[model samples]
Target: MLTLTEAASRKVAEIMSKQTDPVAGLRVFVQKGGCSGYSYGMSLAPEIGSGDWVGEFGGVKVLVDPESAPVLQGVRIDFVESLQGSGFAIENPNAVRSCGCGNSFETEGTAAEGSLPGEMSV
Candidate 1:
């Protein structure tokens, strides 16, 4: 399951209030690219794909495509602020190595359907 910290939930609610789009939810996806082997992408869209998993926390909605859900499972989302930054962060249990930017990851997770988990520990 995906988890959201209190700060993250508030941040998500704030963002939802700002968006005019009638989205199904916040879409989270992973693809094969980035400094690491994989990169995560998120957006608010009008529809959810057939393979997407939809979840909610504190009345805010989040979506993850099936392809990305396994890799993202058991992850925590947090909001943080500092002199240099204010943004969302992902705490994923399945990543073996993440890039310096923290936006990309490489792991042997079960990111594929019907496949054995990779060299990652979830």
Candidate 2:
């Protein structure tokens, strides 16, 4: 299962509050790309797709697709504010290696086939 820290939940709530569209929830997914091997992606989904795993935390709905569930299991998300800046941070136990920027990661036993180069989504 995936978890979100209080700070992360609050930030998601705040962002959703400003959206004019009726967002179903925050959609988290893993796509093939990044410096390490795989990258995480997130978006405000209008509706949950079929077979999606849904969880509620801090009064917000979080959605994860089946393909990404294994990779995201036991992951903790938090919002961090520092001198450099502020943004969401993902703590993934499954990641064996991650880029210095912390946007891309590689998982043990998963091949990095089909990965493309691009900006990470969050």
Candidate 3:
């Protein structure tokens, strides 16, 4: 399962509190696209699905679909503030290669073996 840093957890909780509707948790998923073959996506989920993997960190809930769980395993999310900007950053051990923006990555075997479809070599 993925983990969230203290700053990330705090930021999530803060965002959730400002929402008018009740938030089930933060949903993390992977979709086909990006220069590295896959891009990470996140949103505030309304509820958990039966097949979802649910976990809590620093008092905030996190939801992941089965399809993304394996790819996201051992991932770490942190909130960063810099002179350029402030946003969430992800560190994924399963990613053998990633794009310059860090929002997309390619896992081992999938892209290395030329099995990835419509994915550009980085």
Candidate 4:
């Protein structure tokens, strides 16, 4: 349901390559409490969970928890670098509005509909 651009996938792989511990893949999820009501979070997952939606982009495995699935659907992730900075940028089609930081967003209806109760792992 989610797609990552080549730049994003490459960045993920580059980060995973330097990890000291085992990183099964990247875990992406939505959690409540951002300035715009929800925010995206990511981490190097240690293992895939029973109900996670898994996908591989540019050879980097991406794991999304069931709760975050709907909100993240149709989202496109890209990595960008410029004089300002370099980081993963998320463009979520479902979002009605987003905070200036971009990491936080608000969608139609209640964010609680697809947001995790708290920050959680895949």
Candidate 5:
């Protein structure tokens, strides 16, 4: 079960209210990039193709693609702000390992083969 904190829910609602397009929902995908080999991606999108699992949480709609669902199960999304900066954070209980940047995760049971938790050195 994917969940969102109150702050995240409000922020998402505000962002969606400003959109003019007819959207299927926000999408959560894991990409290979950033200081971590995996990064969380959010998109206020209007379209969804097949194999997209729609997750409705915190009174909003979110799309989690099939490939990413296992890695993201029981994850909680939260928004954090400090005097220095503000951003979204993830509380992933399933992660066996995570990068320092908090963008990547690797699970003990099903990590991709040869995929490191952090990005490649330049």
Candidate 6:
């Protein structure tokens, strides 16, 4: 239930190829505790979890645990290289607000007051 840009898929595949362990796919999840309310985390999955939601985009497999499925719906991931730096950037429709760093976000029903300098309310 998410989309990954070609750049993101290629980047993930490149990184996975360097890992010593056999990489089955990418694991995407959300966890509590960030400047906002939740933060995004990703890792290379060596094996798929029993309850994970799996999808393939641009030939790259992505795994989303059950707990993160709903929150990650309609999300788009992209890899960007810029003078500022390069990394995976997430555009989440479920995020009502996001921290300046772009790694943290707050969903609807958990909206908080006061915005960080670079935070955006979507």
Of the two candidates 4 and 6, the one with more favorable lDDT, higher being better, is: 4
Q: What's the residue-level lDDT of 42 in candidate 4?
A: 90
* TM-score of each model, paired residue for residue: 0.82, 0.89, 0.88, 0.88, 0.78, 0.86
Q: Note the clash tally of each candidate.
A: 2, 0, 0, 0, 0, 0
**Candidate 1 residue runs with Cα over 4 Å from true position:** 110-122
**Alpha-carbon deviation at 21 in model 6, angstroms:** 0.9
Answer with 1 or 3, whichever has the higher lDDT.
3
lDDT of each: 0.75, 0.86, 0.87, 0.86, 0.74, 0.85
Alpha-carbon deviation at 98 in model 3, angstroms? 1.0
9-69, model 4: which lDDT tens digit per residue?
9999999999999998999988776788888899999999999999999999999998788
Per-residue lDDT of candidate 6, residues 1-47 (tens digit): 99999999999989988999898899998877789888889999899
Please write out the lDDT profile of model 2 over residues 16-49, one tens digit for every residue.
9999999999998898777887899989999999
Clashes of 6: 0
Residues 27-108, candidate 1, lDDT per residue (tens digit)?
A: 7767767776777777776887886788888877788876677788888888999999899888888888888988888766
lDDT at 51, model 2: 90
Q: How much does candidate 3 score in TM-score?
A: 0.88
lDDT of 3 by residue, 11-36 (tens): 99999999999899999888878898
Residue 70 lDDT, candidate 4, scale 0-100 = 78
- On a 0 to 100 scale, what is the lDDT of residue 122 in model 5? 55
